[model samples]
Target: MPMHPIEVDDDVYALLQQHARPFVDQENDVLRRLLGLDGSPTAVANRVSGGDLRALIDAKLLAPGDELVHIQTRKGLTHRAVVTADGNIRLPDGSTYAKPSPALKACVGHDINGWGQWIHAQSRESLQSLREALRERQAD
Candidate 1:
């Protein structure tokens, strides 16, 4: 699971406290149930209902996982992701990130696909071979 660090303000904190009060069993539950979790390390998923969950998610105070990802829209968002064996990115938003063009600079607009643009090979032969291989494979 990926962890997105977020800052909470006093106002939001107070609101969460109020909403989570009845569900909370104690301090432990206050952190858990208020966050609408099963008390496991998996973290609160985006699939949860209610305004409070949305509030927390938009604030970045919480992150939704694989099972809960569809509950949210990640249209223009980008996250630090890793590449798999097939050259696909395991995106933080739980989406597959394809490679980007060379002009893909980190601009304020347009989410950059870092995996797509990052240099892949150091050796000249490897680079040429992979490039040709990918082109041929895609053409077929």
Candidate 2:
């Protein structure tokens, strides 16, 4: 494949950096992942191999397509995201985030603890609590 160069602003570059896997993802890899161009079997396998939410799914704590909700009383806002088959969080607009924090941050416009804030819509349980339960199970 031939490589081409394109220019992006600082913010765009930073966004790519945030989504990148440290030391493992080059710029093209990050771009491919973010752009949903990594749909090949190998790419899907690599993507699903590991992630925070993937662990939860493996433990049966969260199922794929489960909705996670965040309520910001101060801003009078409610945001929703769904867990993808590979454990990524997918917002309604079709953007997928690899981690909870960045997923919530995209909606809230600031840094927040997504594990504590994003509630499982059906169970009304915070992800943090679920994580704790998974931890306890593992420790046994």
Candidate 1 on 46-71: residue-level lDDT in tens? 22333222332343322343111111
Overall lDDT per candidate, in order of appearance: 0.35, 0.82
| Candidate 1 error regions (>4 Å) | 1-80, 98-108, 111-116, 121-140
57-121 per-residue lDDT for model 2 (tens digits): 98888999899999989989999999877877877654577778988998999999999999998
Clashing pairs in 1: 99-116, 100-116
TM-score of model number 1? 0.21
Clashes of each: 2, 0
Report the Cα lDDT for residue 46, model 2.
37
Per-candidate Cα RMSD to the true structure, in Å, reads: 16.2, 9.0
Model 1 residue 106 lDDT score = 24
